[model samples]
Target chain A: MTKNDLEQLIETHGNEIYQFCYHLTGCREDADDLYQETLFKAYEIRKKIDKSDVDSPLLKERNYVLGIAIRLQKNLYRKKSRRKEELLDNEQFEYQTELASDFNTEEKVEKDQILAYLRKIIHSLPLKQRKVIYLFYFADMSVKDIGKLLRIPEGTVKSRLNAAKNALRIKMEEKGYE
Target chain B: MNNEEMIREALKLNIDAPEEINEKVLRNAKHKNQGVVFFKVATLAASFCIMTIVGTGLIVKASTGKRLIEYLRGLIDNRSYVYENGTDTIMTVYDNNGEKWEHVEYLDDEVTMSHPLSENETEYNLYLKVTGENGMEHFMNVTAKVNEGQSSEDLYWAIRGDFYRFFSPYTAADEKSQILAGLKEAADNADKDFIRDALIDVSADLENNRRILYEDWPADIWGGEGRYIFFEDLSDLPVGKCIIIINTVYDDEDSFIFEINIDGNQLYVNDVSFNKYSEEYYQEQLEKNLPIYDLR
Candidate 1:
C-alpha cells in the first residue's frame, strides 16, 4: 500500500478510535495522545503491511491500529498511579466537584443515595481491585479480556473481581448502606 | 443478589465521546493503508495457495466426517481451550477469561446449541459484548420484534475497525458506524431509560454458528450477509403462539432471559421453564412429555 492509502484509512477511523481511547482512559488528553501513538505505530509497521493487504476487507477497515490504540491506553492506565489526570473541560469538572460537595448536604438524598454510595464503594477499594471492578462492571468486559490486557491469568482476574465485590458487600452491610 | 440489574443499569449509562474521533479513525486507516499493500498481496497469494492445498482436502474430509458436531462441541465447550474460533458460526459465550460460561437458564424449547433460533417475545434485547483477551470491551445491540407474527429488526453496532468490506457491498461497516455515532450523538442528555430502550433487540440469527447447537436442524435457520442478526419475519404466526429457538451467534452463554407477553387473547408465559419437559430432564419429562404441547 502507498502512503496515500494510509492517509485515507486514518481519515476514516481516526476519530472513532480516538473516542474509544478516551472512554477507556476516561480522559481526553490521554485519548488524543494514544491516538497519535497508534497512528505512529501503524506508520512504523507499514513496511510489513503489504500492497495487497491494503484492499483486504479487514485491513481496509479496522485492524492493528485498533489493537495498538487499545493496548496502549491500557498500558498507560496500569502504569499511572497517583497521577490525577486533569479533566480538560473545566465547567463540567467544576460542576461535578460542586455536586460532590452539595451531595453531602442533600435533599431527596435517600432516593439517590445509592448512586453516591456506589461511587464511594468504588473509591474506597484498593486501586487494582477498583480497576478490575470498574473495568468489569462499568465497561462490561469479560475477565479473560481484562486478564489479557493486564497480563494476568483469568483466574486471577476472577479472584480480584470477587475480592472486590466481597469487600464492597461487607462495607455496605457493616455501614447499613446495603 | 441480582446485581445483574445494577450492573445493567450502570452499563446503560452513556458516556459522551468527542465528535472528531471519527475523522481521527479515518486518518489512522488511511495512513496504515500506505506501504501495506505489498504485504496484503503476499498474504493473499499465500492464503490462496494454502486454500487450494487444504480446500480440497477439507471438502473431502468434510464429506467423510461425522459433521464436526461431536468433535467441535468437545473442542468449543472444552472446559479449557482459548483461542478465538472466529468461525463466526460459533455463538458460545465465556467468562472474563476465555472459558465457556456454564450459566444456564432453561426455557420451554427443546433447543440445541447449534441451530439458528428465532424467539418470539413481547420485547427482546440482546447485547453483544467482547472483552479483549486483555480486558478492553466492545459491544453491539441486536433487537427483534414479534407482533402480528412479523419481526422487522436485526441490527448490530459496528465500529470502524470491525466493519469489513469498506469498498465492497459487504462493507456494512460505514453504515454501522454512522448508526453508532448517530446513536451516541442522539443520546446526548437522554435519560438512562431511553438509551436502554434504544439497545433493545428482537431476533437472534447466525448462519450455522457454532454457538448454537441443534440435536436436529429444526427446518428453520436465518441467514444474511451482515455482522449483526437475521430475523425471519414473524407476521403470520398465530398471535399467541410461541416457538423457542437458539441462535447463539449473537449470544455465547446460556444466561439469557426471554420474556413473552400477549394481552387477553393469548396465554401469558414469561420465561416459561422447561426443565420438567426438556430432554436433559428426561427422567422426569418421560412422565409428563405428551401432556405439554398436547394441551393445545
Candidate 2:
C-alpha cells in the first residue's frame, strides 16, 4: 500500500479502532498497546487488502482492523494468561470523563449517573462478553460480522450479547434503575 | 431514550489515543517498508505455501479442545426446575478460593402454591427469606398476580423483574421459542399503541419494553431472559472449579468468601466467611456441621 493509503486508513477509522481496543482490554494502558499493535499489523498486510473488494470504504477499513484485532487479542490473551490469569482483576481502570457545559444542571446530573452506572456495568462484564457487547453496541457490527471475526457461529454471538445484557440488567436493577 | 439509544450513549466515553502510539506504528511501518528487498517469484511462492501450512496447523490446534468461554458458559444452568409441590429451593455456591457454603431460600406456601386463584383478578406477594451461613440475610418479595385465565408466558413476565426469580427452573432456548412466537404475534400488528395497551391489560408486569419499541424487533432481545440467568447442577462443574467474586462497591473492606458444591441433584454453598471472622476456624466448623435446613 502507498503512504497515502496508510494515512487515509488511519485518518478515517483511528478513533473507532482505538475505542474497540479500549473496550476489549477495559484498561487504557492495555488498549493503547493493543491499538498500536493492530495498526502495525494492518500496515504490514495493507498490500493484501483490495480497495475495490467492497463498496463501502468505511466497512472495509473496519473489517481489516477488527480482523487483525481479534487474532491479536486471542494470542495476547493466551500469552498473558499463561503468565498471569488475573490481568484486569487487580488493577483499577479509570474511565475518562468529560463534562459538557451545554446541558442544564439537572439534566447533566441525571445523564452523568446513568453513564456512570452503564460504564460500571460494561467494565464488570467478563472479557469475552465485553468484546461482543462492544462490537454489537459500540462498533455497530452485524451479528454475522462479529461471528466471522471471532470465529464463532452467529448463535454464539447472540448468546454472548444476551448474557452481557442480562448481566447489565441485573446490576442496573440492584441500583434501582428500571 | 430507549435501550439502543441508552446503550449508544453509555458507550460514549471520550478516549484519547496516546500520542506515542501513532508515532510508534508509523515509524515501524516505514522501517519495514524501507528494509524490504525484491524476491524471486518462485521463492516468494514457496515461502507462501510453507507459511500457509504452518498457519493452518496453528489454527487447527486453536480450534481443538474446550475453550475457556465454553466451560464458563455451561457454569450457569439455562433452566432450573423446582418440584411444583416443593416450597423451598436450595443450592450451593463457591468463592474464588474454592470454599463452599449452602444457600437456602424458603418460599412461603402462598409463593409456591401451584393452584390458580379463585378470583379472576387476584395478586399474591410471594415472600422468600434467603440466608447464608455467613449471617448475611436477604428478603425477596415478588408480586405474582393474574387477571382472568393466565398463560404460561404471562407468568414468566411477572417474575422476570427479579433475576433470581427469573432463573427458577429456567426455560431453555428451544422451550422459549413459544414465548417468542407469542410476542411475535403482538409485533405483527401495525398499531404499536394498541398492542401496548393490550399487553398492559393482559400482564402489566410483562418485560416487553423492546418489543413495543420496534416493529422488526429481534428475537434475541426477548430470548435473553431464558438464554441468560440459568442454574447448572453443581455436579456438572469440573473438578476444582473456582469462580471470581466481583466487588460491586469500590471498597474491599466487606469482602466475603463464597464456595459451592453439588450433591443429590441439589447445589450447595458449603462455606461463607466474613472478613471479621476467623476464616480457618469458620471453615472447620462448617465441615462438621450439617446444613441449617435440609429440605430434601
- Among these predictions, the greatest DockQ belongs to 2
> Per-residue lDDT of B1-296 in model 2, one digit per residue for the tens?
87667777888756666767776666666654443311111111100000000111011111111221222211111111222122344332223212121122333421211111112222322322333234333233333333334333433333332222222221344323323333333334314343234334323222321111001111122211121111112333443323312221222432222222222321222222111123652454355333322111
Candidate 1 Cα deviation (angstroms), residue B137: 43
Error of 1 at B79 (Å): 39
Looking at model 2 chain B, report the run of 10 residues with the lowest lDDT sum.
Answer: B46-55
Clash counts per candidate, in order, are: 86, 28
Enumerate the candidates' DockQ scores in order: 0.05, 0.15
Candidate 1 DockQ vs. native = 0.05
- Model 1 bad stretches (over 4 Å): A1-26, A35-70, A74-113, A116-127, A170-176, B11-13, B32-296
TM-score for each prediction? 0.31, 0.43
Best-matching candidate per TM-score:
2
